[model samples]
Target: MSEDLSSKLLGPIKLHLRVTWESQDSEIKEYIEEGIAYIDGICGESDYSVSGLPRILLKAYCRRAWSGNTSMFEEDYRRQLLRLQHENGVRRLRRKRNE
Candidate 1:
C-alpha cells in the first residue's frame, strides 16, 4: 500500500481497535500491511476503498492478529474470503475481456 493510503487507513483501524494511544501505532501499521498481504494473497491485487468489503476483511484480520488469534482467522472468515476471491476473479475476467 502507498504511504498515503496507509495513513488514511490507520485512523479507522485504530478506532476499530479502540486504540487511544500512539504507543502501538507502529504495530497497528504492521497489522495493516499484513492484512493487505493476506487478503491480496487470497483475492489477488485489487483496490481497497475505505468502506469496501476488502477493507472490512482487512479490519477483521487485523483484529484477529492483534489478539493473537490469527490461527482461526481463515476458518472464521472462510465465506467472506471465498466471496472476495470470486469477486476478484470475475473482475479480472471482465478486465481481460474488455482488453
Candidate 2:
C-alpha cells in the first residue's frame, strides 16, 4: 500500500500493481501476473499502453473509457424506454380494483 500501488480499467482492460518487500515473492508475482492477464482479456489485442508509458496516462485512459461506456449504456436504456412507451400507451391510466 505505497503510493505506487494503483488500479485502472481502460476500455475493457484493467491494470493494477502492488509493490512491496514483504518476502512474499510468490504472492507478489501472482498479483502482477493476474493484472496483466486481466488487462489482456479486457483489451482484446489492443496496444492501449505505449511502451514505457506513464502511469498517469494509463489511468486517464481508463477513466475515459469507463465513463464513456456508462454514458452509452444510459442513452441506450433511455431509448429503449421511449420505444416501450411509444408501443404501449404511455399516458394510459391504471384501473384500480376494489377489494
Candidate 3:
C-alpha cells in the first residue's frame, strides 16, 4: 500500500480496534499492511480503499490479529473470502477480455 493510503487507513483502524493511544500506531500500521497483503494473496489485488467489503474484511482481519486469533480468521471469514475471490476472478477475466 502507498504511504498516503496507509496513513488514511490508520485512523479508522485505530477506531475499529478501540485504540485511543498513539503508542501502538506503528504496530497497527503493520497489521494494516499484513491484512492488505493477506487479502491480496487470497483474492488478488484490490482497491482496499476506506470503504466497501475489502475494507471491512481488512478491519476484521486486523481485529483477529490483534486478539491473537489470526489462525481462525480464515475459517471465520471463509464466505467473504470466497466472495472476494470470485469477484476478483471475474474482474480479471473482464480486464483480459478488454485487453
Candidate 4:
C-alpha cells in the first residue's frame, strides 16, 4: 500500500485489535469508526493525536466502548479520565498564576 493510502486507512481512527491487514474486514472497521466517533463526540475537533494524555484516555475510552460489556473496565477508564482532567486543571491554574 502507498504511504498516503496506508495512513488514510488508519486516519482519525486508531484500532488496537489484533487483526492482520488481510483480516481487516468491514465489521471491524465499523467498530473502530464507532469508537472513534464516540471519542470525538466528547473530545471535540482535535486531530486525535497519540501524544496527549487526554488523547490516550480517549483511546482507552474508545476501547471500552467497543468492548460492549465489562463496566469494571469502563469505571477504570473513567477514573483515569477524571485524573487527567484534574491534572490539566492544575496545569492551567499554575500557568495563570505565573502569567
* lDDT digits (tens) for residues 1-99 of candidate 1: 777777788899999999999999889989988899888998887576547789889899989989988888889999999999998899999999999
- C-alpha lDDT values of all predictions: 0.88, 0.34, 0.90, 0.51
In the order shown, what is each candidate's alpha-carbon RMSD? 1.1, 17.0, 1.2, 6.2
Tens digits of per-residue lDDT, candidate 4, 1-99, equal 133432443533344544456444554455445544654444333334355755565455545655664356435666655665566567777879999
- Model 4: per-residue Cα lDDT at residue 85: 54
Residue 63 in model 2: lDDT: 42
Can you give the lDDT of residue 77 in candidate 4? 67
Of candidate 1, the 10-residue stretch with the lowest lDDT total is 43-52
TM-score of each: 0.92, 0.28, 0.92, 0.45
* Global CA lDDT computed for model 3: 0.90
Better of 2 and 3 by TM-score: 3
lDDT comparison, 3 vs 4, better candidate: 3
- After superposition, which runs of candidate 1 have C-alpha atoms over 4 Å from their true positions? none
How high a TM-score does candidate 1 get?
0.92
